[model samples]
Target: MSYSKPRNDYINAVIIPGYTYDSKILVTQCPLEETVVDFWTMVYDHNSSIVVLLDQLNRKTPLWLGRQEVLQFKDFTIVQDNSPNPEELKLILSHKEKDPMSITVFTTSKVNNDAILPSNVLLDLLKKVTECWKIQKGPITVVCSDGCSKSGIFVALKLILEKMKIDDEIDVFQVVRTMQVRRPEFFTEFDQYEYCYRCIKEYLENDSVYANL
Candidate 1:
């Protein structure tokens, strides 16, 4: 089944295969004010419980609701539950009469546009998302303002980390090259290319940090 609905359903989003599942990722640009409802519909329809908001958005109203606050948009209602950190939000998305789905929204402002996230922070974020996926077992939605470099790099590192766990090997080059075929704008910069290798090396150096992951 395709996580990507028809063009009319949700625009500017595409499905990308993940390390363990065939169609396990939905990479998209930050939703515009007018398209926010469509974005939530995509999440609701796809049954995605994890949302990785890579960068800070410039919009007036934040996409997520505040603690214990709820917002309604067309057929969707978003409720924000308490979270341990401000960076991670627990959201419940409900459509009309269907069962409400709990989604974890991981947001990081440390990554500015075109800027790479620090290796340690990126790995920590990846580990959290990975662990969530391990228990939930579904597609992850990754969003960035422009939906290219940062989001793509995040997914690339995720796949690389998964590959390391399964095969005990790392091939940053091949993983990136393959993802680029599906989304041409992924990992577009040379620095981003180099950052992947740096992250892998860092993960190796601090094995204990992610020992459980």
Candidate 2:
């Protein structure tokens, strides 16, 4: 549970282990209109500076990220910044008496919540996320609809990449098995699991991609 709304069982969220203190990913569902404030509160409480949205935004999402509206959510006041592309949005969040924080949002190419994004599309998302991690050293929050299917694939790959960067090797089965203990049904589909292996192989065999990881 986050510092914000500790007793409320509103938002479905969790913290997955990561390569660094600031590299952990908080997996969660897309917030409902009523839960939007809780979503930002969780982000603020976790010090998460980036949100990787893996599906199309629901009606409430836009109102929450309304352009030019400095909406106040509980103790936090959020302001939207310029979007570099149609798929991404940036926001500056001010938590009452605390310093303002930057929160960048990135989306996968697919619109369906449970869609198993293609390997190529996931690769592109990884590249974009690498850039976001460079800018913010806090935890990254990832959302789909339910938070465990596609988000699982993305988080698993993210951890694999982080390990590859430092160790140059990884055990695919061990990584997925361990994550499943904490997050049941992670990478729910068999195809997604195969895609993970395929992605790893692509990264290891390709010097250009390996260099970046």
The model with the greatest TM-score is: 1
68: Cα error in model 2, Å: 2.1
Candidate 1 C-alpha lDDT tens digits along 103-203: 98887658676566898889988888877777887889999888887888888888887777788888898888888888888876788978888888888
In the range 1-213, model 2's lDDT, one tens digit per residue, is 433544363557788888655677789877777778778878887888888888766875652456767877666788887665756787888876678888777875475754667777777787888776876678889888777877888899988878767776886677788788778868667887788899877776775764554
> Which residue pairs in model 2 clash with each other?
none
RMSD of each: 2.8, 2.7
lDDT score for candidate 2 against the true structure: 0.76
Candidate 2 segments whose C-alpha is farther than 4 A from its true place:
1-10, 61-63
lDDT (C-alpha, whole model) for all candidates: 0.81, 0.76
Q: What lDDT is obtained when candidate 1 is compared to the true structure? A: 0.81
